[model samples]
Target: MNKSVPANVTIVDHPLVQVKLTQMRRKETISSDFRRLLKEISLLLAYEVTRDLALTEREIETPIERAMFPVLRDREPCFISILRAGNGILDGMMDLLPSARVGHVGLYRDHETLEAVEYYYKVPSDIADREVIVVDPMLATGHTAVAAIERLKKDGAKNLKFLCLLAAPEGIAEFHKGHPDVPVFTASVDKKLNEHGYIVPGLGDAGDRIYGTK
Candidate 1:
């Protein structure tokens, strides 16, 4: 992690994560490969982000005797996808947590203003009680994430975390400013954002790559 990144951020620096992230960064990687890599990386990220989930002991009957087993103490968490690109990461995380509730916070960044404009928002009615993990592929200008989290908080969501594949120092800083209490989880934090508000040396536009829009 870079010194400029917030202390609240957690970088999943596993060797497998680094390798797949490097492959995703390559321009030669096709849409199919890029999408596949994101899914694989999401699984790895999901594992790390959920590492601190609460657990409790449950006594169950075995063939010969009773045994105490560890099981999640709380209900399945909810995954709030930040629209199109987020769905890529959301899909993989869902594979590992099929029972987890799903939500969407639709937002788009204005080209000239570079501000996030929300069009829709929906989540489990009990969002205030359950853990919430917000997923988006890139943390570019950070406005989208900041705006999304703001909305979630307004809807009574108290426990929240942000997850992404690639991040920039600028984005992380901006994000921290907005939600200092919320932690960020990512595979890599890049150098900076370009003049166009894109993460430098990032995997290009994640939505474009994921849906072949470019």
Candidate 2:
């Protein structure tokens, strides 16, 4: 399989991201704590993901003097969370971009076919003109990622990005191979996927960990 992931697809290696991930990995972390850490880590990841957002200057009058103000140049980025697991990451990103538009895509892996089956999808009507960031806590198989992107592309979204908490090498390769132009941001890339398609040494099912369900 192709191991060459995008050079632009950054995996954040900050100490804080690592520390929070460690807490998230612990088996004892309860749903509440897991949810909290997911939010915090998502915010940190957002910092890197949005670093290059265009900024514009505007003149402003301060209490004492006139000054130049800087704000995001393009329309604020829209967030598209990939359902249940993605919502954990979305909560944090929303705290940072509260005014930004939000979208949802619901997908489930069909047990029999092992395919990504979409049940619901909604996005801003003006997606073609806005930058979009797709969030999901885990990118395990890349099937969902590829399918999700395909849906987004069909919706007319141009500039698109994918962000995840963790990914496996196989999944990362699959994503890149399927959509080499899209950049991905992740916290860590694990060794590989196990027999049942779980990322080995991963923090278990992210949804189960965050929601306290099996």
Candidate 3:
């Protein structure tokens, strides 16, 4: 069977995103610097992820002139962080969208089973009525992202988008299979996953690198 990257996937190939991504991928990069890079790149990624936020025109006064300006139609999106690594992206996104509601899903992949296991979950009561942006730095096997989205949808999150720093082809395929309606925005799609389910040529364990837990 022929395979393809999902049509809903958007690659954010902006120059700054690519450059910071390279820095984060380097083994010699210190954890502090890696965390800094992740946050910086995440802001760039968030800019693209929120590009389609609803807009409305409202009357406003600009200095000596009265005119209509395009403003957000509603509250900022509700953001769900997939876990510890997800927080790295969340911080940057919050910087960009200060009014965005924040939530956390403490989901992790079982090392041996390669399945997502959720330990914690919380979100705004109005998640169903607002757009949801799910952030995680890496999408390796995709189980984590799938599980997180499943939880959100179960909670009535109708409009959702997945944002990640890097993704593997296998991961994207798996994610699409489970949630084809949700669009994915990522800085780059790498080659493949290695035997242990790590994205090939990907930055090392995002959570570990971000928190210096390794």
Off by over 4 Å in 3: 1-4
TM-score of each: 0.97, 0.96, 0.96
Q: Give lDDT tens digits, candidate 3, residues 1-214.
A: 1135678999998999989999999999999999899889989999999998989999999899999999999877999998889999988889998999999999978999999999998899999989999999888899999999999999999999999998999999999999999999999899999999998899889999988898
Q: Please list the residue runs of candidate 2 whose C-alpha ends up more than 4 Å from where it truly belongs after superposition.
A: 1-5
lDDT by residue for model 2 (1-214), tens = 1235569578888999989998998988999999999999999999889888999998889899998999788898999999879999999998888988999999987766657999999889988888899999888889999999999999898899999999888888889888888899999887888877888778998989889997
> Best by lDDT, which number?
1
Clashes of 3: 0
The candidates, ranked best first by TM-score, are 1, 3, 2
The residue-level lDDT of candidate 3 at 206 comes to: 92
> Pick by TM-score: which candidate is best?
1
| Deviating ranges (above 4 Å) for candidate 1 | 1-3
Query: Could you list the CA RMSD of all candidates, in the order they appear?
Result: 1.1, 2.0, 2.1
Candidate lDDT scores, in order, read 0.92, 0.89, 0.91
**Per-residue lDDT tens digits of candidate 1, residues 89-146?**
9988998989999999999999999999999888899999899999999998899999
